[model samples]
Target: MTEFTLIPASGAAVPAEPFTGRHLIDGLWKDSADGATFDRVSPSHGVLVSRSAKGGEAEVLAAIAAARRAFDAGDWSFSSGKSRSEILNRVADLIDRDRERIARIEVLESGKPIAQARGEIEGAADIWRYAAALARMAHGDSHNNLGPDMLGLVLKEPIGVAAIITPWNFPFLIVSQKLPFALAAGCTAVVKPSEMTPSTTVILFELLEEAGLPAGVANLVLGYGDPVGAVMTTHPDVDMVSFTGSTGVGKRIVAAASGTLKKVSLELGGKNPQVIFPDADLDAAADAIAFGIYFNAGECCNSGSRIIVHEDVAEALTDRIAVLSRKVPFGDPLSDATQVGAIISDEHLGKIDGYVREAQAAGAKVVIGGGVLAVPGLDGRFYAPTVVAGVTPDMAIAREEVFGPVLSVLTFKTEDEAIELANNAAYGLSAGVWSLDVHTCLNFARKVRAGTVWTNTWMDGFAELPFGGVKESGLGRELGRFGIEEYLELKTVQMRVARGRNNWVAG
Candidate 1:
């Protein structure tokens, strides 16, 4: 094991008491029917963060019933788009006003850098504003080409009661990705945030109430996947399920939701790649590559965990990325100076280390940082920013989602070979290409199997662009106009304007 620089916790104040989180049902906040509760200790700070109601079948059932009633009664589903848009915009404003507070809670709960959490809060607010605009711009198509006797209309309507299950990695941002869009589509929802981080969602619910969102429009249940998430997926009343998590768990959600045959939209795992060419700007590519792998401590679905580089620049590019990786701050997340923070848990830290060790045992060379990090005055778990070289396509570290600040480097000779190497994984959520030539960038983008392809950039996302995956990466899309469509259903209406419809019977 290597000893790296230790970062001590900032002397910032901790909450005197842990936050109290309860279920929000029918515009009321209450405890679980059985008085069950759970607690979250900060993964970075080693202190209690929150205590939340543990929702079981009874609580989940209540939330589903509330959403179903809210949808069936048309209180929100039939409301004017302008009304919904106004409320969404107000929520956006509220989010911006409380961005710092929300960011602090997220940092404490998720063990991510404070700066990154703050940026996510800002981005989440922007998504809310975008969803608000989407609400008003939503529309139906009218077919005027039909004969004068007949008119056809295609209407987009809310899918009704939706069950939204968000993961813990990017809690606030992920929920913002799903909930606002579902509401913008005029659907009521039962939401279950990961039990590990539930306070921020509770805060968002407060903002929703303050924004004048009607009762039973959006409900929250805090608990584990079993009982809570399981019921949300299979319930007879749930019209749709939008989930963001591991592909394995995503498969389970699909199978469970199949019982009801409800609509399912998933944003799952990724073993994303960034391909570097000989003609690429080495300096720029190296910088982006380092950021891609270390951002979110590489606990992101879009983490650029593996790099496929042309043989000509393989050694030089690998050295540059290795040098850059060491410079990325890995320490206490509370300090603004820290770039990478603690792993989510001791178990997760072990899982990340296991992948690296297995790769090393299989003949992979670690260029730098191949062990645990010791941050002063903190007992929380943290892994070093590792760079493994000589990684083969068949190696697990190169093909699997390591979900840590670990980078794997592999080499290729030709463009086709690079594309083949990039597309070799079972997951294809995203990929990036680095090249100055227009033809190479376009050709590689066209050949790649990922849902989102970046040219000369890695993980530059926007609210206007659609995001999702193909194959085992999971199904459907989120964000942009297509995102709102996930919560909607289409209906065709044909009318006979001229006296009466043509009759088959003898007149």
Candidate 2:
């Protein structure tokens, strides 16, 4: 394991302005046009951390213009892939070099456990490196079958300016996943990170600049999704829009992008399922399920919110999960021992609580936790890891995305019924199968409607494998060759060899 430097928070007071209150546009930090700013409160202590520039139409327009100029001038696009890859590698190194500081900022801003935050920082850096490798590896092909003198070739070109809108949850990770690939593909980008957790992204923009990305090649706008997000999606100059957020907002973005006919890639919300079988290891399965739903405070788009277990094992699995959920610590995000941290904000916390209340009112059993946890000496948006059994497939708690540390449990007797239950929702982002049989694993992998299915594992991902969803979950892919291709456009060139082809016309 790589030893990471830990920053001590023993100082009496943190800096008044821990982060710069400006938008990163054209490779420079600038304030919002209207001088508008929003306070970013820490979810851990409910205190104001920093005020960030609230970008609106004017700032959005400036970012789009800058990105368009960069792409139209072929500044980044004309550069060699090796050169681009080198710059991206430098970005990864910078992140790794400053991992501790970045992790602290993420924990403070996003209310994730310090350990998890550090891991996220490491993962973000890895994504940059992976994208850097893909930059040099992005190649086209040639095929010949017509005639000796005839030839056909295909080339993948940059898709011009890309508008990268990332969600508050996993801000750094989502940005790393999209921006690096866009830059690697020689495309300029205008980034709009969620205002709630804009600090890490601000740091990322600075790092990208430090890596020597040219002016106008990358930009960041911090603001609400309505105006800033709307502008980015509808911008005439932005040739592509890549977004990761809720399905509702994703639909709006797609609708907005239709006006300009821009390419769109969406990684939307999910109500993913984690199914356990009677023949599986119940102890390991319970631990994995606990982590899957409670990790990142259950704010992940692909969190296993739904647990579908075989009827023979449902009771044992639920009991084990409930017991484990109680053991998982939930407290201050800065605590090293804390496994579950606070939700993004009070509003989200209230929403999650509402779901639990409704489920109980609807006569469901709250086997473990189902209420807010008010920790002493600390005021944070913390919710205990909740497990609600006796949930039906059509219940609101089971169908809707609560986006918190809440789990809905259901039972199935047969493989066909399990598949039907898992595929019941509109989402098809990811699923998990816990079975010892090879045939069972292969069968579930083929039958599950999700984009990624894990056998004996849940929410585990790598850069080598593609990640995305089917059906209402979203479109386009992230990671792997498919992810790199999202930023490229294929062009085919052909040549005719027959000099005597005009004989028919002459006749």
Candidate 3:
């Protein structure tokens, strides 16, 4: 087995924090109606980071009213696309300027590796830039030859009062994915970020406000999901809802939105597959698999949790994966040498531990690092990079989303069986295939039932690509042009070219 050195955490100097708690509503920061507050905890040390206003029904309603007023008053929708694009570009620049600070906050609040947080910060900034460039390109179409004396055209206009709800994982990046596009499409928005990690979102709103967006164009509310999230989804003033989270909660959001027939776009959960063929580059395959499942402690919605390898090469691949998993250093996120940071909370840690225990009880072999690791001098939620072999498809860990640093290895007989096992799950969000053979790669890519397929790689994403799922994974799309289209409505206009107008009844 080849040993690889972990990249030391970057000790980059971060800027002095300029923004804190307080929600951004109507271009200003304020407390909730009842003055209730929630503590922001540092998942790295399990300490209180700060306190933010705990928004509830009254706060959510205020945000909705502000958004509705902004849309109906035509402050944002009346602006030209070029104007919107310019403001978005400015916001992107501001994000870049504060990237280091934002990355630090992300690392501190979410307990992700500093390196991964930096990448997420960069990705979020790029999404803003991409959405900015797309702002001026929301063009409508003109239809010719509708009739000899009639001219027709189709127009795309902004959907009013968008409600954006993002998950705790990739806090800033996921919110950026939807918020920038919503603003670019000339829609007013109320953002509800997960309470687990709201610091980055609060910083983002400060940057948005600094970008000089019109008053009431963007609002922020922080609270628990059930009350605040439900209010946002069910509010009549909210025209559309864009959410990213677990599939179980997504169904509830759908049910709530159905009452008013509100537009909805959900990016839900996944039990993604990483298939390794016999001809794959063993070293790269093992490394990719390790990073795919262990990165951010496998909190990603598109985490490659299931490993479907060809039976001939399954033993070799499993051995290599186990070796790699051992090398994944689990420690404080602030340490530059830490590769795997702590899980979000103790509840999530217990959930992941339960999955491992259940899988072991079901006769799966615990190959390496299958439980919690108590590091000296580190008091936080931590889980070791776990690998389970001899896992059957019927095992709970093999079928459900463990959402932790846990990987289940299953074998397949052939390419057809690999695709079958990969697509057998209820999720169709993301999948990865590793093969040196071009034909095998193409076949797997074409046959896989996932929104994003990586050939010879894993978890490589950009803001320019559209991402979502089929089946139970999600509805609609995020990022790229598709993201912008989600916040728009289409309308058809027709005009007659008669020289003299005459009433049909009079004639």
Candidate 4:
């Protein structure tokens, strides 16, 4: 296989765009009011990629006001579903058309492998199309027999302006998870993408505008979480907030939204488990579980960090996982051959390494790779795929969300013990189960407290699956019909067929 330690941006295979400090608001691209900016560097090489607008409270307010105005004007909120479908289709077409440019921007900032980045871009396109279909299929319930004298109709109405704050790890894909659904429900939105990776979202606005999306239907404000995210979450005009990030931040958003009692949908962190029964295909289970955690450098909130194997097969599965872990190529994100790329940044890389070291100090054994890997001629933030064994559920590495390429292997003596250990974490986002027996897989998955379960599979998600979590993992859901429901409110219309006014209240 061809290999290279580092390649200059000039020689990068992907096409480059003119990255700038512009955030779209009210259908116009403008500099932040204070003219301040933040540098966005490629995590692959720690080199400056572009300067982005560091929007603050002033911009946040402007965007919210714009969204509120657009909703109140009924420009998009009252449009025919067929018209909305056409617009959404055009938006998807643009995404597919510019997939290469968008994928390149995603890899540069988010540090995802080129192939995965491309996949995310294409996946987002599919989501847009699926959401378009949902727009046309927003069916409401009709009750013709509520009462002989009474007629009732339950209608779903838009929940007004939404504040969409997405995380750095799947910048474009995460936004697609929320934004398109809100639009499908005819809700206008003011979005705040992670400052670390705002290029793709900013570019997305250009496409939405080209798709004939009305001015202020969707707005993007780029900035850090504090002044920007905090303000947007609490903004009185914003009727809803859909956030995907840390559970800590998710809590703050809920608190901030309490003032307005706005609807909140949170897709947060997880310490997801991968359970392997003794009767499972150990080899296949090991490889799939390793990929579950290592995909996207293990920045996934649903990373299957807790690999709970039955005692009978724990040693063998752990060994197989170590072998699979080593084969994952960690290098330049632009390299098509690279399966694992750099961490989001230096600070994030340090946090990941710290977690691994702490786990090792607590009596956990480092199976294969446990530290950061170097890329010659460059100080890129790359961490090796790590497999740690002899871990207890009480260990911080097992309980916490590392969001890195580190796996903790724990053993269980019985199915009951495995279930207990898996549910010990404060998170319950998702889980995976592997077993040759269909009954075992189904029963075990049903017992897990997570939102989604994969029997004999891992890290598989589609636009049609309702994805979310219980407990502290998150609130509400995204994707499928449920995603659109989060942006709508139920209204009942009742009328008396007798045409006689009842004076019971007055009497």
Full-model lDDT for every candidate: 0.92, 0.87, 0.87, 0.88
lDDT of 2 by residue, 1-507 (tens): 111111222222334665666798887789988899998878876667878888989898999999999999986898999999999999999999999888887888888888999998999899999999999999888888867777888999999999999998998999998999999899999998888888889888889889899999998889998799888888789999999999998999889999999999999989999888889999999999989998998999888999999999899999998888877877767778777777898899999999999989888999887887776556677787889999988789999899999999999999999988988998999999999998998898999999999999888889888999998889999998788899999999987765644455653
- Runs in model 4 deviating more than 4 A are 1-18, 501-507
Q: How accurate is candidate 3 locally (lDDT)?
A: 0.87
- What's the CA RMSD for each of the models? 1.2, 3.8, 2.8, 2.3
For residues 1-507, what per-residue lDDT tens digits would candidate 1 score against the true structure?
233445687777778899999999999999999999999999888999999999999999999999999999997998888999999999999999999999889988989989999999999999999999999988889997899888899999999999999988999999999999999999999999998889999999999999999999999999999989999999899999999999999999999999999999999999999999999999999999989999998999999999999999999998898778767778888788988888888888999999999999999999988888877778677888889999998899988899998999999999999999999999999999999999999999999999999999889989999999998898888999998999989999998888966689977
Worst 10 residues of 2 by lDDT: 1-10
Task: Name the runs in model 1 displaced over 4 angstroms.
Answer: 1-6
| Candidate 4 residue lDDT tens string, 279-377 | 999878987887888899899998888899898988888888877776777787887887888899889889988988998899999887787777654
Highest lDDT model number: 1
For residue 60, what is the lDDT in candidate 3?
Answer: 84
**Count of backbone clashes for each model?**
0, 0, 1, 0
Off by over 4 Å in 3: 1-20, 500-506
Measured with C-alpha atoms, the lDDT of residue 4 in candidate 2 is 14
Query: If scored against the real structure, what TM-score would every candidate get?
Result: 0.98, 0.96, 0.95, 0.96
Look at candidate 1 and tell me the lDDT of residue 230.
Answer: 93
Ranking by TM-score: 1, 4, 2, 3
